[model samples]
Target: MKPARFFTPENLQIVKRLVSRYPPGQERASLVPLLDLAQRQHGTWIPPSAMQEIGNTTNLSFEQVFAIVLAYPTSFQWRPCAPQLRICDSWMCCQKAKQRDNGIFEAAQSIASQYGVEVKTTSCLGACYGAPAFWFNDKIHTDATKETIKEIISKEFT
Candidate 1:
């Protein structure tokens, strides 16, 4: 049976382009990228329907596609969450927080809670030199301050 299509026409074209990047027998290699694109298109989550479409396009079963998703929980979300703050939990970030005694993670969590923003701690945001870092609304803040976080969240939520 034909899988239910989830991607819009433009996204479907992008998906085809992504798949084409792999050789004929290696289309499955595009699964992760496809999932990322699907999540971005869906505004933060890959719904089951999108997964089904990805599986169909990649010649994988739904279970197979889901297994890949399960392996990378941080990369894929099953539900939509906006106004997100992703704190870096790398060793450097942790140490920087400790040194500053400002608790970037704790402070961000507190501020995000007040503003109804979702907060998560993910792997390195690739700003070790800056030490403390977090991503909010698609922008990464390095050497972050609690006041800055509060200000940004207030502006975004209120």
Candidate 2:
């Protein structure tokens, strides 16, 4: 069978460096960081080829790596996604949304869909004081409203 090659030479060096951080026989410990690096380098998703390469580099089975990746949905992106819109749907944010009747998250999903952005609901964004928070491409925006959400999505496309 042909070898699976995905990472660039520099990224391969980085993968080796990450693997070297652990004790000689514990390269499996580098799996998560290696997946993270591969995701970042590959523009946000880890493909099967990269998983195979990572397994080979770390002396892990392909199934082992795939299992770990599947376990952490938020950490790894198995497929490509448009810019993300992660809305906080935890207690404080939901309560605030209900009180204000702004439908911030719903509007965000609507706006994101128009722009081909992906919307995900997260537990907490750590901005409870400024509830109704969300992350546009990982940048937190607290005290958000539907208009603000629309504006943010609009700015992203333009």
lDDT of 1 at 20: 97
- State the local distance difference test value for candidate 2: 0.86
lDDT of 1 by residue, 1-158 (tens): 97558999999999999999999889899998899999988987689999889988999999999999999887796644556798889999989989999877778888888877889888889999887888888788888889888888898866
lDDT by residue for model 2 (1-158), tens: 97757999898889888998999889999998899888988877788999998898899989999999889878796545658888999999999999999987778778888888988888888999999899886589988999999988898789
Pairs in clash, predicted candidate 1? none
Error of 1 at 45 (Å): 5.1
CA RMSD of each candidate after superposition: 3.3, 4.1
Looking at model 2, the pairs that clash are none
Misplaced by over 4 Å in model 1 are 1-3, 20-29, 40-48, 59-61, 80-82
Worst 10 residues of 1 by lDDT: 74-83
